[model samples]
Target chain A: MRSLTAPRRDPAPSRLSYRLQRLALTPMVRVAVRRGLPLLALLLVLAVLLGDADRRAVLTDRIADLRMQIQQRDEFMVHEIRIDGASDLVAAEIGRALALDLPVSSFDLDLEALYDGVARLDAVSRTDLRVRPGGVLEVRVVQRVPAAIWRGPTGLHLLDADGARVALLPRRADRPELPLLAGEGAERAVPEALRILDAARPIAGRIRGLTRMGERRWDVVLDNGQRILLPRADPVPALERVVALDAARDLLDRDVAAVDMRNPARPTLRLGAATALRLRNIKLTELGVD
Target chain B: MTDLYQSQRAMRAMRRAAMQRGVIAILDVGTSKIACLVLRFDGPDAFRPSEGVGPMAGQSAFRVIGAATTRSRGVRFGEVSAMQETERAIRTVVQAAQKAAQLRVDHVIACVAGGDPRSYGLAGQVELEQDHVSEQDVARVLAACDMPPIGEGREVLHAQPVNFALDHRSGLNDPRGQAGQMLACDMHLLTVDGTTLANLIHCVKRCDLELAGLASSAYVSGISSLVEDEQELGAACIDIGGGATGVSIFMKKHMIYADSVRLGGDHVTSDISKGLQVPLARAEWLKTRHGGVVATGMDDREMIELGGESGDWERDRRSASRAELIGIMRPRVEEILEEVRARLDAAGFDALRSQQIVLTGGTSQIPGLDGLAPRILGQQVRIGRPLRVSGLPEKATGAAFASAVGLCLFAANPQDEWWDFEIPMDRYPARSLRRAVKWFKDNW
Candidate 1:
């Protein structure tokens, strides 16, 4: 049912008017689209690249700062050192011993290793090394006290409590007040016997050198060279009985070359080569009987 | 063909036959080096295990026939990496030692460092056939311990029965002739990677030596380094080698656990090289000459010259301060200690009654290490040297050579190995699954 006839239209506008409209709108739209997109994309790329470069710069700067800080810290720490309880060690000698030729300010000293090296000296028993907050080095040393002086073929060496050879005492006008040990195996035997003697210190002063014969028996020599032959069995009782006899009869003062305590019950005394005194069943209580 | 039981019997005979021989060589395949020691056990009186830590009765008795060491090759973290290189190194050290001893040997006992070794504490019970227990019964009770599924590619390195618990009584060191209806055993099974074992055995065979026995390097090191009391109670040995550091825990004179850390002295040297911008060889030399963990004030001004080869006047004349050297060395040492602390924590070192920690090995020689180690590793730290052995060179007695000297003592008096006695594998109890699960839960 569509209408077959079309309606009439007004006359077309002039070419001048059409050209004016096109001229007014085309360049504006083109400029808006073209300028906006490229500018946005360029801005985004530039931002991303700048961000990456900034991050790299920040990381590099941080690492450089850390390196500087470490170097500064090391330099700052190198100046603080304190030495404690080093009276016995000469400063020059210690420096020489540690092989330190650099100036004090330039030397990064390892106090503990230095302490260990110092402790390696026979005279040093214990040592402690510590660093204070300011990088000051502090060292403390405890010198070993010689328990006895062992006279060997090599030289006169100082012995510690455990019978370890400590050092050779310098021969001078003033020597350490320690007991002297002599004989072939006296150095080995004295330490062991001294441990036992230390347990019995009340009478320890009366004895001097202890000589072991055949590795089983021991001969205790008095300070005045009186030999006391100790029995193999029950030596403690024999020692105690001798102490009692000496206390009661002053037998140590007798002109005797040797006293045999082999039999705890029967004590024998050799005053001289020909004169021998034999006392049988000399019990601790028998001191009053004599 | 021998059945399983007959094969076990024949294995026992073979063990006895190996023991009767006079000389046995022990090779300690450590990450740092391969050491071979040939020992001659002069009958029963020559060596006796101590009752407790005191002066050992005899000192001048044991004879060291010969010893030698070579740089370990093809070993990474204690496990054999390249079999051929390891074999060659072993052959070189063993041949040199044999020549020194002027004797040819066949039997060899060796110790390895790595294999992801795991330990389990197992208890087993058996009713006595008689009223009183016998040595046979003791052996039977030990054999009754169910062998847990050791996993594929793994073999038992050490399966030692540590303690025995008789019926209504416990801590019975020896249960023979004791009256008990039930005997329970506390056994420790140490398992290592089977591939590692095969490689070690192959290397020994290629060197033309018979396998007398094998021990864990950490176990033997603990045996030689720890005092008797420490071993009887409990202790740990940390052996810091050039390539790796080994850790072992001992209780009741037996190794309860062992482990290794891949970092060691080599890491420290590398850190120095990178920090100082020096060559590795120069860094090592500097580390040995001037390295210290704790820096002192005097170190800042101490200048060390860097030898230059390019003839650049400015670079050749340049010097770095001592404090700078310490700065490079401290952090790496601290990291090593921290790693060791973490390992000890994992091993439950704090739970031990006598928690003695002994430090040995080449890296332990660092300056101020003893001081810094105790602070990081907790209390009870000591620097350990090998127990003074007869005829050992003075240079070889330091902490660096603990494993070498320990191998000597181990070869002389070998503890019972896993294959020494018969193990009834067929009668394994089913409850071992639950035990293994429990161990996994506790350890992992």
Candidate 2:
């Protein structure tokens, strides 16, 4: 209901609140204040809360523990090595070459480097290394086959058909049945020397060994103290021709100390000591000029 | 007609938009200070069954995320006097609050005072469309309420259906989903000076903001300051502001009547300035620091020095006793209280079962007002502050922010108004004459 009394009225008045308002933080003032003082206060509080060394140590220990647990999981830890396709000697050499401690974590093992190292042994041609289940590390080794014996200054080394060294022996008698090669580069022409040995199998009883000539050719030696010079290129064909002549005329059995076949087109033979002496006396008497 | 519809639509749209965004700002535009508070509303999904039991029923849970208050300017007696200046001031506090909240808000629900708001109770009855009364029946009953003849230069600010009666059963709050042949409603309508609202709307618009909703500061102050029991029974909240004292009566959790006494804290300051012959600023400081109505025997010995650098020796060193300062402030405060008492009495406040009176607002800080208010207003008086809200700045959560906080409650659980529903165009057939009759019967 409307009343007779008017609301007691007054003129508007200005206030001291304005001065108080001026002291308040406007965004403009807050920007500067936050940069200088308030920001530092906030950071100081945070430092007090988070900079405790005890908490840091606990956190760091927890992180290290987690890392170790991941690394030492049982799924792939390599406790032992299983070798396949290897003889006892080859496996022993490979074990020495590997140089790994048993019961090692598989994560720490470098399988590629292990394969290369184990395969570089004299008896091993290739290797397959893997960490199988049940914490076992398996090394599959393939040992090279010895094709011939090479008499080097170091020792009597067994060689494969490709002239790679397989193993070292104490003496030549250790492998008497294998054909032997002696010289600086005899290992380099192992295939050619083996081919020559095959061609002279018809006189196998008289054959001794093959020697390298300046790394360019081969000289076949006989137990009868004869030597045959073989050409470097096409040495197999030249040796085949010698075998043909030996089959037709028993050329290898005559008293010839040396048959030089370096020039395939012209063949020559040096007489033995007795044959040369008898031939010299007859020629001197006939010519009366000795 | 279109203006009313459009304005109502605009307000409703803003409510929708604010609800969709789940955050809005409440602004209390007063003479002494302008306050802005940003509220974060947890949406419908955020409500708990435990929530529906309080005074804030069906209200979204909200927190005061940002708050900023500054000295008001270009406003007198709770009305904007200078357009540009008020716009700038509104922009200032709103921007500051937005910065604090780290968000931009377009919707604001504002509260104003000293707008000459008038309240009237209108009754209506309508035939139900079906056996089971629906929301439409309630709407029809409210529409059937006679729109009275409020004079020129006045606008309807609030139209809330205070009570509803269905057929044989009366005192029904909601008739929906109930079988009834007849529906009835008792609606309370409030109107204010049209220019007072237009000025605020234009000022808000000039600030490049939307006028989402507007409320009477007196009504909102009661909403936040009065306790649940006080509101449920009968109580009045007297908000003694800077330029005006706002008075509102509430019963059953709704405002039944509201009036304003246009003298407030500033008047007391003026009295001190005139009595002591000091600057207005110094008088305010004295009022806040040393002014009080309840003078003790030792008050005669306590002296306040008025120091100044004006270079006038006698004026610079003048001193006054605390008793003398209280002597000057008490009368203006008493006059405002007496005026509020008269208005409350005229509203039949004493006839209500509970006549508890609550004093809140900036000026309510005067010491001994609780004792002084009871004797002068002749009621059970108590000083009230707004209920606590989360994250509210320590300073802003005081009694001065009652209306600002109340605006948040009003925005959260806004009492449904007539404009929210579609009214038949012909329903307002007897608008002016009936309103004149109602006004004459109530006042004369």
The top-ranked prediction according to TM-score is 2
Q: Quick one: best lDDT, which candidate?
A: 2
Estimate, for each residue in B341-362, the C-alpha lDDT of model 2 and write its tens digit.
8999899998999979999999
Query: What's the residue-level lDDT of B168 in candidate 1?
Result: 84
Task: For residues B178-282, write the lDDT of model 1, one tens digit per residue.
Answer: 997999988888877878878888888777677766667777788788877888889999988777787889888878777777777878888877877777767
Listed in order, each prediction's TM-score against the native is 0.53, 0.60
Model 1 misses residue B381 by how many Å?
0.6
Model 1 RMSD in Å is 42.1
lDDT of 1 by residue, A1-290 (tens): 34455855422223354334334334555576689779989999878876887787987899998876765565445453344555444344444556644334323566667776777766666777665556555556666677887777787888888777777866622454566666677677665666545533555677775666565666777878788887866666666667777789988777788889877678888775444434333453477654
